[model samples]
Each structure stands twice: as C-alpha cells, then as structure tokens.
Target: MIKELVAGVVATTWKRLHGPAQWRILWLKHATFMIGVTGVVLDDHDRVLLLKHRFWKDCPWGTPSGYIERGETIEAGFAREVAEETGLTVGQVAIHKINSGFRLRMEVSVIGRLIGAAEPQVDGVEVTEARFFRRDELPDGLRASQREVILAAGATS
Candidate 1:
C-alpha cells in the first residue's frame, strides 16, 4: 500500500512539473488569461473558409483559431492566425461579433475577402484540411457554434 502511495505521489509530481499540465494547474488555481481569435474569410461566391481540426477527433471541424500572442492586438492575431492556417492574407478585417465567457475568452469574428482564387495550403499542425464551403452545405463534422458563425457570415457577405 505504501509503495502504491509513493508511486501515485511521484506521478502527480511529474505531471505538475510538465509544461502543459503545470499551465493548466496554474490556470485553474489562479484566474487564467486565455485569449483567442477567429477569422472569417469569404470568397467571391460568399463561401466561407473553414478549417478541419486535427486534434479534435470528437469534433474535427473547427474554425481557424489561435491564442493571441503577447503584445498582439486581437485583430493582428486574427489576421496572423488566418494566414498561418490557410495561407491567405486577410485585408480589411472588421470585428463582426464578440463572444466572451468564463475563461477570459474573446471570440472576435472578422470578415475579409480572399485576395485570389488560390487553394488553401494547410500550414498549421492543428489544421488537417482547409476548404471553402457554402453556408448551407457546411460539413456535418463542424461544431454547432462554428456552423452558426459560418452561416451568419455568409448571410452578411
């Protein structure tokens, strides 16, 4: 029994020492300052660019999202995330909506038009596929919130 207790303690200590686990613990213990940005890119046909996430196997379809880097405005972060994920430079980004909740969250939806008819080159590790989909024909794998956002953006595009 004592041996088992010692092993458990060691395992707990090792997890605490790991980077991501430590960050999660600190975030839970103290108020976390988690900030994220999402980009909405519209094509000439009004189709919206969507990213299929590689990590979220349970919910594989998600928007192009990333945490805002230090000293980065939400707009800059949004633009950078879009370019990084889809290889498209966004121009004339406007904050269409904001969604904030319990985790110091900021969901800033910005609208931008695709500069050219180039295919998206998936560059981010989180993104497995990047494609444009009509609002009405969005893939069933997308999260409900993401589908809603795409539909709303399409209507206004």
Candidate 2:
C-alpha cells in the first residue's frame, strides 16, 4: 500500500510537471508582457483582406488577429488567425513591423501572400464579412490601428 501511494504521487506529479499546465507556467514566466499578432494578407490583385466582426460592430474593420497559443510559433499563430477568421490559407509570412508602447501590449504585424481559397468564408457568428479592399479605397469603419498596420506593410513591400 505504501509503494502504491508513492507511485501514484509520482505519476500525478509527473503529469502536472510535464503536461499542458507546465506550458502555461513557462509562458507566464517568460512573458514580461502579453503579445498579440495580426496578419496583413494580400491577394493576387494586391488588395488587403479585412474582417468585419459581428461582436465588435462599433469598431472598425480589422485584420485577422489573435493571441499566440501556447507552444505555437508566432508565424503559425498568425497563419492560424487568418484561417480561422477568413478561411483563407496564407503563404510565406514575413514580419512587417512591431508596434510597441510603454505598458501596452506589443503587436506583431506579419505580411503574407494568399496561396489558396480566394473566397472568404465567414461563419456569420464572429466574423460577418471578409473581403479584400484596395489600399486607397478601403471600406469605411476600418480601425485606425489596423489601417496603419496595412499602410506600413504596404509601404515596405
């Protein structure tokens, strides 16, 4: 009985130390501040993709963005954001710029070319519309931050 208790404690302790919880603990330890990521996706016509979120109707149209997942690389998370929000696959993600402010979350803007799935598939839940807009003729209600990211990325390309 004593041996069994020791083994069980060891097993549970191992699981807690090496499981998903460990990742979160490590992430928290390493993260001095939270980080966010957004992708500037361009289609064949050089237009940028923007999403209209249903929940944030009052906010302007924004690019596909989300927090980086535990154990996921920033590029992978960026691509995942594009796919989740617009149902579009991205190729060759490259860092455009890093937006940082004192005491504010840092955002990484990545640029990528759309590889497949030209038409966007919005679920009508979170994302209501996903469409490509020309740089000079972007739709109204585009968030200023997103607009700046797009313009800055466009300038470097």
Candidate 3:
C-alpha cells in the first residue's frame, strides 16, 4: 500500500513538471492554421472593386477575401476566392501588399485584373453585394483597413 502511494505521488510530481509541454502538444494538435487572401480588382477608370460582406456586422464594406483552402497555394487561393465571391475570372495576379500580424500568420493582398470585359457577379454567401467605386467615391461604411487598401490600389492603378 505504501509503495502504491509513493508511485502515485511520483506520477503526480512528474505530471506537474511536464504539464506545460503536454499542454503544448495538445494545443498544437488542435491549432488552426489561419490564412487569408484579398484580391484588389481595379477598373480602367482607376475604380476598385469592393464587396459588402454579410457576415461582418462590425465592418460590412470589405474586399473580396477568404481563407486559403487545404492543398491550395496562396496565389491559387486568392484566385479561387475572387472567382467564388465575384464570378469574374482573374487574368493575372500581382503581389500588391502583405500584412503579417501575430503567430507568423499573414494576410496576402494581390492585384488581379479581370479577364476581358466580364463583369463581377456576387455569388458567395459572404459577399452580399459587389461594386466598383473610385477612391474618392468610396462608401462611408467601408472599414478603415479596407479604405487603406483601396487607396493603395488606387495609387498603383
């Protein structure tokens, strides 16, 4: 009986000593790999495409953004998100900007040109509406970060 009690105490001490490492192992198993991509579409008139997101109650006016799906490259993910949100096919993608905040996760912004004269069609659940607006004509409800991206795209357009 004493041997059994001593064994229990040793086991408890060991668990307390390595508890953090075990917890880290468990956290890594459940950690989500967060990634996001944004497409900056510009019209010939220097107007930028903006999507009104239905899910975002705090900031509705945002860009066409979505997560990078499993087994997809960043560029391909951006193209897929653009096509899924707005039915326009992207011709070419150019890395416009990159924002990294916390945990080595990144939000990649790419400038995509619409193929031919195809218009944008909002078809995704997240994207409720889509429209092109000039820099000065940006809607008042746009998020501050989105406004910054639109102005940056305007400068390069």
Candidate 4:
C-alpha cells in the first residue's frame, strides 16, 4: 500500500512538473556526490598538522583539506592540499573515515605520513600558519569536526 501510494505520488508529481523539474527529479535520482578529501596527516612523532587559513570567516585552524579534482585520486588530492597549504610532503595514505549526509557532498578522511625531516613552509597568503601540534595540545578555534577527525586518528595510533 505504501509503495503504491509513493508511486502514485511520484506519477502525479511527475505529470505536474515541466522540463527543469523533470531534470531536477532526474538529478535527484542519479546525483553524483562531491568528495572533499581531508587528511589526518601525522609526523613520525604522531603530531597532527594544522593550518590557519586566511579566507575563513574566523580563520579557524583545521586539517589540510580540499575538494577532489576531476580524475585525481583521493590520496593524491589529500597530499596536494597539504603541500599547497603547508609546503610539506606526505607519504602513502589510506582511507580512515567517511563523513556525509549533510548533502550531496562527502568528507573523506585519509591517514598519511609526513615524508622527511622537513618543516612546513607556508606562503603567508593562503595559509597564515602551518605546524604540527601534539595530540593533547591542539590550538584553539579548531572546527569540531576536524578535532574529532584528529582525535579519531589519534585513537588508532
């Protein structure tokens, strides 16, 4: 009965809609998710990297993250964002967690290791500050979701 009612509603709604509405419903049925990759990158000492971005409303500290580019692998995008914002290279990465449901966008947290003994060198433009913080002593103004990602990554260490 519920299925029939739903089907009836869909049929009724479908008939009342025009071209754009049809496309919207079609998109709703076959929407592609936008993936934003977040890195829980850590150094050998298990310190988590944090960045203070300039364009943010309050310029809060957060992990290195960006939307995945077309045809770019998740790990590659993760490393790229870190390098672009912090000027630090990262090694291999593996998927750590997936957070979604706010909309069609998804946040993928990946675990990656810092490459060598090099320190971060931010450009002082897009990124104002970049450094690693001890797990127990993260700075103020960290986004709750990012803090949770950092803590969850720490738990797995």
Which candidate gets the maximum TM-score versus the true structure? 4
What lDDT does each candidate get?
A: 0.77, 0.82, 0.77, 0.86
TM-score for each prediction? 0.71, 0.72, 0.71, 0.75
Model 4 segments more than 4 A misplaced: 1-29
- What tens digits encode model 3's per-residue C-alpha lDDT throughout 1-157? 9999999997787688776877776678764557788867776676778888889888787778888887887778888888888887775677777787648467877777667667788865778899888777877777666677766776776
Q: Extract clashing residue pairs from model 3.
A: none
Q: Which residue pairs collide in model 1, if any? A: none
Model 3 earns a TM-score of: 0.71
- Scanning candidate 1 in windows of ten residues, the lowest lDDT window is 102-111
lDDT of 4: 0.86
Report the CA-based lDDT of candidate 2 relative to the real structure. Answer: 0.82
Off by over 4 Å in 3: 1-32
* Candidate closer to the true structure by lDDT (higher is better), 3 or 4: 4
* lDDT-sorted candidate list, best first: 4, 2, 1, 3
Off by over 4 Å in 2: 1-33, 101-104
Candidate 2 to truth, TM: 0.72
Residue 56 CA error for candidate 4 (Å)?
A: 1.8
